[model samples]
Target: VNILTTLILVWYSPDAKADAPQWTFLLCALGLFAYQSLDAIDGKQARRTNSSTPLGELFDHGCDSISTVFVAISACIAVQLGYNPSWMFFQCFCATTLFYCAHWQTYVSGTLRFGKVDVTEAQFTIIFIHVISGIFGPSIWSTKITSLDVLPLRFATVAMTIVCGSVSLFSIFSVVFTGGVGKNGSTVAGTSVLSPVIPLSFVIIPACIICLKSVQNVYENHPVLYIMAFGLATAKVANRLVVAHMTKNEMEYFDSVLVGPVMLFLNQYFNFYIDEYYVLCLCTLWVIFDLMRYSAIVCMEICDYLSIDLFHIPLVDHPITQLNKNGTTINSSVVNTGSRQTRSRRHHH
Candidate 1:
């Protein structure tokens, strides 16, 4: 829903201009709030349905990885940061990088830690920014504060993100460098502590180099597309990190999702045989498909191996013997009906 609403806003204001209609921002706020509410409840729902498994954790974090990208983009658009593609780029990548670092540390520490001011708070802050933008106007972000430097309110978000990101990075690095649960202070998969950086660089390095070197200014012209492509690429790697943590498997540095960025980089290297914008469009499409395909395949594989269903609660009914009023015994069998069954087995799908 958040992605859909963001697309609507993009349609209304392709560049997220300050003069875009107020309704677009309101829609974005509602969508993000809905996303946050749903994300919070999903775990509870899983536990309630007795379907909680390792797969549930994987799926939850996987969705979060993808949502981080959309939320960051929407937030940047809400603040009219598209006017400054550099800041917009930093904001979006900052979000993805922080998210990746969180899991990267988890990959080492074998635990997911949340700080006092964590994801929930950050999400609410973005929602508030959307509300204010919707109520006042996107132009309000450009209003200069009474400071010696006369900074815009939008720049305040950049400052806050930098501080928060710095603290988070510090905490994550402390965990990663200190040691892992494995022998000799390695990662959970017993790989090098610094191995995760290689995949991350595959996303960030190409993004910076390609965007900076593009003769056609593809990124500056279409910041949303460029960011979304790289964002999904980043999410793919982050998801792999989660998988590695959960399964205790070594994560390879090379990822198929890197193909998208590589294409853009090669296009720049070739001096734009084809239009860079078209390549970006193709890159976006490919990354979206690749993420979905990989996620679906992984979920299906896990479900099959665990004898579980991804979306449904599996119920097994057992027979019960009851005593009759007349002192006779009555035997009743609980059939394998649908979800309304009153009896369940020890193992759930």
Candidate 2:
């Protein structure tokens, strides 16, 4: 359903009509409405039907990841920022990263937390913003509403950067706070320290590289190519998170996931032509990876459901169970208890 909506947005995206014609905006409005309404109830429906398998979870998240980029893409058109490359990159980069952070929060803390300004709320707000833009036309985003910035593109770009940065910062700090301070006020050491930094590094390393490259080339002027590059990189990171969730493993996937295609997107400001084939190639590779991973997950889930234990893939297990359920998975007491039990069992034998 969300895919259909995305296709519809792509269909109407090139409407060269003056002010985008209210009718085109209406189509986008209707599509977003249908998607959000149905998407909201999909999980509950799955749970009701007792079909909430791991495959369903994977399907659900994958759809969300795709729709997130599409929705932001549509939003860009709605607000008349479609012609700009910086806004495009900002939308895709922020949306995909924040979605991953939500999952990261779950993996480490075992808590399914939705932030105060999380995705659900953001989508709902965008829906209304689309409606307003549809009614008022794109001029509303540009009219002087404040002294800070009058243009929606300018305002949105800055506001979005701050919000995305804030959310990323909070998620990073959440990791450190998870184990950084002990009851006795001592600092967490070794693996505990690395765990917090691992997730942070995933976003930080990519952001650092992308921003530096953006600065050197002034990528803001070439939003089309900038978004394509950033989107591909973000997709790779999101894929790693999905694989991590499926396998129940904690793997380091930072910039190490950057393959050949993403590298070509990195250099230069003087050259201005975007290779459509280049973008399509990267996108196709992404699709193939998504399909294979998704198929493996579906097969794994079906076999698990049927109680047929066969080949084991480490990607689907919960990584934090190594810690106790009460959140002491890393406590010294638990470690010592297991050590003592091992010696006692040997003695009894």
Best by lDDT: 1
lDDT of 2: 0.53
Model 1 pairs in collision: none
Residue 161 of model 1, lDDT score: 95
TM-score of model number 1:
0.91
Models 1 onward score TM values of: 0.91, 0.64
lDDT of each: 0.87, 0.53
Model 2, span 1-349: residue lDDT tens: 5446544545655421125555556666777778878788878765544445566566667667666766766666666565445555566666666766666555554444665666666777677767877788765766544655535443564476567568765965576356533333222222233343364455446544544554334344334334444454455556556655556565464444354234434422334245434543454466446545655665676677766433322222122223444544441211222112111111110
Q: Positional deviation of 79 in candidate 2, in angstroms?
A: 1.6
lDDT of 1 by residue, 201-303 (tens): 9899999999899888898889988989999999999999999999999999999898888888888888899899999999999999999999999999999
